[model samples]
Each structure stands twice: as C-alpha cells, then as structure tokens.
Target chain A: MPKVTIDNITIDVEEGTTILNAARKIGGRIVPPAMCYYSKLKGSGGKCRTCLVKVAQSSAKDPRPMPKLVASCSTPVQDGMVVQNLTSPEVAEARKGIVEFLLLNHPLDCPVCDQAGECDLQDLSFGYGMEETATEDDRREFPVIDIGDKIKLHMNRCILCYRCVYVADQLTDKRLHGILYRGDVSEISTFIGNAVTNDFSGNMIDVCPVGALTDKTARFKSRVWFLKPMDAHRACGKCPGKVAIWMFGNEIYRVTGRKDQFGEVEEFICNECRFEKKEPGDWVIEGPRHIKRQSVISANHYEEMKKQSIIDPIAGEMNKQE
Target chain B: MKSLTNRSKVVSNKQMTFWERIYFPAILNGMRITFGHLFRRKATVQYPEATREFSDIYRGKHVLKRDDEGRERCTSCGLCAVACPAEAITMVSAERKPGEEHLYREEKYAAVYEINMLRCIFCGDCEEACPKEAIFLTKELVKSEYQREKFIYGKDELVESPDPAKRVDVSKRQTKEVLEFKKDKRYKHNK
Candidate 1:
C-alpha cells in the first residue's frame, strides 16, 4: 500500500489503484466530472478526460520531474505522490478544453432531449463552457444513422465517449461494437446493416454522455424537465443484480445500474432489466360516473355514488362483479 | 415506314410594327437584365484557387490526430465503430512493437484503418466515436474521384500533419521524470 497526498490530503491505497479510486476512498475531495467511469469495472479507461489531476512528488530532493497533469481516472497511485486538483491552472484549462470539445458538435437540442434535466454534459458545460463559441460555421453535417429498431442514434450530439461500447463489450460480454477507420473518419458501427438488438440496448441511451444515442420510443415524446423522477428499485428479472429504475409520472422512463451494490464491472443491471417497459395494463386507472358525467361535479357525484354502492351490499356486489 | 402529309393550313409570315419588326424594345430589355448582372459583383468562386471560410466545427475530410510527441493517439479501441451509424469504417488492431513507441502512444494501435469514402455519409459520427482524439474532420470537402476504387482512404492518407502552433515541447527532462515515476518494477512484469 502506498500513501499518497491528493489535494493536500493523505490517503493509503493499494498499488495499481487509480487516483479516482483513491480520491473516492478519502471522500472524493478532488472530484472530476467523469461520465464513463464505472467503479464496478476493471478500468476507468479515461475516455472522458473529465477527471484530470496534476501530480507532484512529496520529496523535493527526488530527481524525478513533476508529474504532468494526467487523467485521474487512469493514473495509478504511487508512494509519496502529491496530487494538486483545486485551482490548478493546468486542470482548469484542460477542463475548459474538454468541455469545449464535448460541446463542439452538440446540437444544442437540450430543450427537447429526455436527458436534459439530468444530463452530465449539460451541467458541466453550464459550469465550465464559454458563453459563446468562436466557431462560425456549422460543420459535420450527416444524416442521422439508424443503427437498429431499438436505438435512435443522433450522431451530431456525440462527443466520442466510449462508455456505451465499453459497457456493451467488456462488462456485458456483448461484442456488438468496433471502431471503423482512423482519425476523424473513425466511427462505431456493427457489421454491415445489422441493428443493435441487445436486450440492454436501452442502457446505451442512459449511458451516453451526450444526446447522440437515445431511446426510439422516448424520442420527441416527453422532455426531461416536464416529467418528475421517482426513485424505485426492482430485482433483476433476468440477472442477479438489482436494477434502479427512474419513473416519470408512473411511467418508467429509464433503468440504470444501482450504485452501492456492485462496483463498475457489471455495475449496471443486465440488458433485460434495463430495457423492460411497463405495458398499458401495468397502470391502474379509476373513475367514470354511473350517470356518465361530462364535468367535474358530475364526476364527483359518480364517485359519491360509487362510495354509496360500496356501503350498500347489493350495490357493492353489483359494482364489484361488473 | 414514314408517311408525309402534303395538306397544310395557310400560314402568315408578316413583319409587324416598330417594336415587333425591329425587336429593339425586347432586345433592350434583355440587354438591361444582362448588363445588370454583368455590372453586379460575380458570385462565382474559382474553386481550387479560392477557398471559402468554413466554420470551426465544419466537418469535412477526416484527419488523424497525433499527440504532443507526434505519436498516433488511437488505441484501436472499437468504440467509434460501435457509435458509427454507417458501417463505412473498418480497422484491424496491431500491437505496438518495442522500439516503435515513438510512432504510437498506446500499447494497442490501429494496424489497418480504411474508410469507404463512397459509402460514407459525412455524418461526423466517426469523429464523435473516437475517444483518443485520434480522428478529426478537417475543412477539406473537395474529395472527388473518377474511379470508385479511389474513394477508400487508408491510414497513410488519414493521419494529419502536426499543427505547429499546438505543438508542446516534451523535453528529455520531462520524459526522464515520467519514466522514473512510472518505474514500478510491476508494470514491466504485467506487460
């Protein structure tokens, strides 16, 4: 175990432990806005670059040069390591640059996106991005690519974060994704015209840091702000882990991996648990007046009649039988 | 077989009054419109010689990214492939050789990468799928070809030249420092 000082606080961690885990052990003082890091998983992979930290050695006499600012999620802890996270010019600049890059292709369609209320990218950009972009032309125009029946991919909003692919391939053992081409020509795709048919396909919508990937059923249906989020948990209908579901007005809008149960590996519920939707019969609706009331007063009268029927044995039995 | 008709209706070919006979007014009107256009600023741009100002976010031709050390940043992680709406990109992964560390930044590198320009819809999905900043869409849209085979672009053509302005100097001192700090005897064994 190595004792490292992160943001001036000292903590002990095992070898190969990333700075992010070490920070978490010590209450996460040096917080980075990481969207792709799943503690249940083996590697942070450092795809988002949001959790950057500057590190230095504790001993001034050490011949080693100061550690260059690297992603905290990727860099492992070292003995006598000193990390500086707050007010560091390098980290701030990196954060600004990363935010700008993430927002570079975002469609500014927050007003309609389902994740707008809880989107990590939106919150981070509001906290870090410049008021106006210097870019003058709208570049990268391509017709939206439809991967399959379940997922509606809006490529324009993607920031290239590989969380969906990583989860799908490494954690879930679904090798559904691969990189094609090199440089800016590279894109994630399936073989030929095969659509994404994984049971956990809906999780990609939740895991996507941007609006690039979305649920086809939920698209253009409801805005995030308009719906209320209720915390609900259900036993994994297919897998061992329990699933955390977010409900909006009795409708289950999204399902995700529940924290505190498992680490990043298999951190989320399996594909089946994540994509399950409540059918029409799943909801219970009450009310219609016996007299066929068209207005609120008549509706109230109908409710009274029902209450009266419940009190009367014959009427109650008739109503119940019907 | 062809049939020729000798029957014909009477046709008049008479010259008209001043405006019709001379066609001066209509000619003048046509000339006025032509002259107006000629005197107006020509919107025609001589392409290949003249270039239009594109937006910073304008996605055009793809450019392969290099790190500060001028090393390729792609780790051959197939995320971009999964995110691509169009299956236009294809790549094979190759492990980096010991001495070739300067060429590639990651242990796993993209060995063969090809893009079917003919099939690509220029959606910038590939640019969005890259995690290492290895790929970008440059503002070079004029990719025309006479033959279909010429449309595919390989790694040799995709890697972008290092931007002189964005270059960072990683001195030997910094490199040595990084090496010493990363000198846990464990990493070598794991590798």
Candidate 2:
C-alpha cells in the first residue's frame, strides 16, 4: 500500500496504482482527466498527456518533487508522494495546453454531428480548453471516409487519442489499421483498398473521443441528447443481449451496449445488436431507464414519492398505490 | 357620424338654377354616372377562379421553411412561440432520433408545432422572432375550415416537405433583408 495526497485529500491506494486511479479513490473534484486511458486495458496510457499533474513532493527516498509535470495516468503512486491537480496552477495550464493540442485539427461541427451531445472532446474542451482558440491559422481537415458499410470516419474531427486503434487491436482478431504517420500528420487509416470488416467495428465509433468515427446507420440521424435510452435484454449466444434501446417516441432508433453513469459501455455488444436489431420487439423492456440524470418521468416519480413521504413513509419507499 | 360629403368638392355649394334644380336634369346626371362605370375595369375577382394580389408586407399565413436539403430548419427553440404577440404559437420539442435526420435539421425538433389560426393576427411576430429562419409569413392563403379544431395548424400543416421540389418556396415573399437573414450560414454542423 502507498499513500498519496492529491489536492489536500489524503488516500492510501494499493502499490503500483497510477496517480489517476489514486485520484479516483479519493474522488471529489480533483479527478484527473485522461482521454487515452482505458481502465480495463493494460498499458493504455502515456499517449495523451491530459492527466498531467505536478508532484509537489515525491517519496521519502527521492526527497524531492519531480522537476516537470508528469502524466498522472501512467505514473504509479509512490508512498509519501504529494500530487497537486486542481490546486496547482501549473497543472491546470498544462492540462489546457494538452486539450488545445488535441482540438487543434478538430472540426467544429457539433450541430449536425450525432456525437454533439455525448462527445468527450466537446466535454473536455468546455472544461479545460480556451474560450477562444489562440491560433488564427486554418485548421487541418481530411475528407469524410467510409471505413466500412456501417462506419463513417471523419478524420477532421479526430483528436488522435488512438483509443479506437487500441480497442481494435485488443478486442478484434483482425486489426486492419494503425496510426499511419507520425506527429501532426498522423492519422488512423486502413491498408490500401482494405475496409474495416471486424465483427465489433461499431465499438470503434463508441470508443472515439470525437465525432471522427461515426456509425453510418446512426449518422446525422439524431442528436445524442434527444434519444430516450431504455434498458433492454434478449437471449443470445454470440454476445450478451443486454443493451440500451434508443427511441424517439414509438420508433426504435438504434441499440448500443448499455452505458453506466460514467458513460462507459458495459460490454462490447455484437454487430448484430448494434447495426441490425432496431425494432421495439427485439428485446424485453426493463421499464423506463433513467439514463441522464434529469428524466421527465423519473423527475415526476421522484416528486410524487417525496409528496407521499410526507403523508405515508411506507407508501413512498414501497411505491404501493392505494 | 359626420358625412364625408360635406368636404367633397363634387357637392353643390350654392343653390342651383331653376333648370339645373329640375328633377329631370338630376335624374339624367345620375343615369350618365351609372353608364360611365360600365366601361371601367371590373373591380371584382371571380371568387374561386381568380384571386387579388396582396401587398408586399401583407401577412397572410404562416409557413415553416425547409432548407435546400428539405430538412426542417426549426430546432424547436420556442423563439416563435415566445415572440408571438397574439400568443398563438404552441410547440413541444423532441430530439431527432436516428433515421429522422432527413426530417429535421438539428437534434431537437418541434414534435408538435401548432399555430392557432383563430388566435393569430398574422402579425409576423413569429417570423421576426424565429432565430433558425424556420418560421415565416407566406403569401399562401390559409384554407378556410368550418370547424374550430381545423384552425390549429399542426406539424402536418406547419412543417415543410423533405423534398426541395415539394417544399413551399417562401423566399419570394421575403424582403431582401429577410432573404439575407434567411441565408445566414450560422449554426452549421459541418463546414
């Protein structure tokens, strides 16, 4: 066990736990943001320097803070290590620079893009990016590419986090592509004349931090916020059938692997469930799901329960109507 | 009420001569005036076959505009309903789902946009209030209905067609300034 103090919050974590995870252990407001790190995957950090934090003090053996800010996602916590995230002005400035670099070539097309509401790039930028871009130079752009029948890749919107490439390599048997170049010219592209034909191709779209990789079936179909995601499950052997059935009124829009409160997909659903099964009868409904915090029915239900609690405590908790 | 004829130049100011005051001369003058109107152009329009042209600023009926792609331009922001001086516009917004992109321009669209024709004074306030250029006053006349329920124009009546060819062309009715406002390239999803 190693003790790490993050932003005046002291927490003891298991040995070799990254500073990012240590922040999570003592979660409040100082949780470091990591774009490239997937908690489940091994060696999935150090690429994106978004989780940069200043070491105010290092281990007793070292007896000195690290001279430069380190990537919190990669650096393992050391005993007596004192890390500063939100409290450190230097850390905040460095995080902003990293986010700005990530958004350097990102196309500002939130209105038409399906990922406008649920996009990580947009979220991070709002939190860390500048109100106005510093560079007056024209932004880089690549044509909208059709990687497969089900996936449309817009290179202009990519932040080059490489999460999709990493996912493809780890999860799929056939890894069609990798980062093709180096530096700012780098891009995710398949081999010449090769198409992304993986069974789990849709997951890349879900994994994309930006709207660069989009599901063709759901492309420009609807904004993410407009969807009413309901929990549904069906019996299947290929993959788990538990999924979030998205709906606009009575029409079943599409289905995706169920996401938790943190917006991470619970499982990698098969392409059959992702692309094909769109009908309401495809799965058994588990009542109305409260995906977003503010759901109309849930809000009303809560209000009703609160009102009932004043009248009768048992009825409020049990939801027993007389 | 005072008669306008008192200010009219055609009215006799003095007593007429004996011959001029005679009933036969007055009757003859009346007959001449009645005959003069026969040669003039017809002021009436054949009710169904022909219609009179309204003035340039005439606010006849409201129409929701569609973009060149035929997708609805309204994001259901409720600016029109808020701007309606007559409090005629009523709408409920819903997010555009997958497969409905061609139907709406943005994520949130008016699931139910109803303009109470009975309440609307055709003030063009909703047209002025619309930020998306989705709603506008059009020269197209509102169809008359016997029932009050028909007066409340729903999305079926308010929304434009998905096909550009089928969309109602209200650009002609818009002034040069409004046309410029309509062509504003803001709020785009892509470059």
Please report the candidate that would top TM-score against the real structure: 2
Q: Please, what is the TM-score per model?
A: 0.50, 0.65
True-contact fraction in model 2 equals 0.08
lDDT of each residue in A116-170, candidate 1, tens digit only? 5456787688767776665655545455667777676766666767777765675
lDDT by candidate, in order shown:
0.62, 0.76
What RMSD does model 2 have? 13.2
Against the hidden true structure, what lDDT does model 1 obtain?
0.62
Identify the CAPRI category of the predicted complex in candidate 2. Answer: incorrect
Regions more than 4 Å wrong, model 2: A290-322, B1-191
What does candidate 2's lDDT look like per residue over A1-322, in tens digits? 7888999988889999999999977764688877887775566778889889999999857869899999999899999999999999998898889888887677665644667656777778888899656775667767667887888887888777788888788878989977898998898888874788888777887777678888778754554555577889988777887888877677777777776544567787878888888888778988556533342213222222357667888766454221
DockQ of each: 0.01, 0.07
Model 2, residue B190: C-alpha shift (Å): 13
Tens digit per residue, CA lDDT, model 1, B1-191 = 33367466567988687767788888899989988897787797787699778776666777677876778877665545545567677776665668998988765577887888877777887766564557767667836889988888998788766666753222221235445744543332112
In candidate 1, which residue ranges exceed 4 Å CA deviation?
A58-67, A172-174, A235-237, A259-266, A279-322, B1-191
Quote the lDDT for A157 in model 1: 69
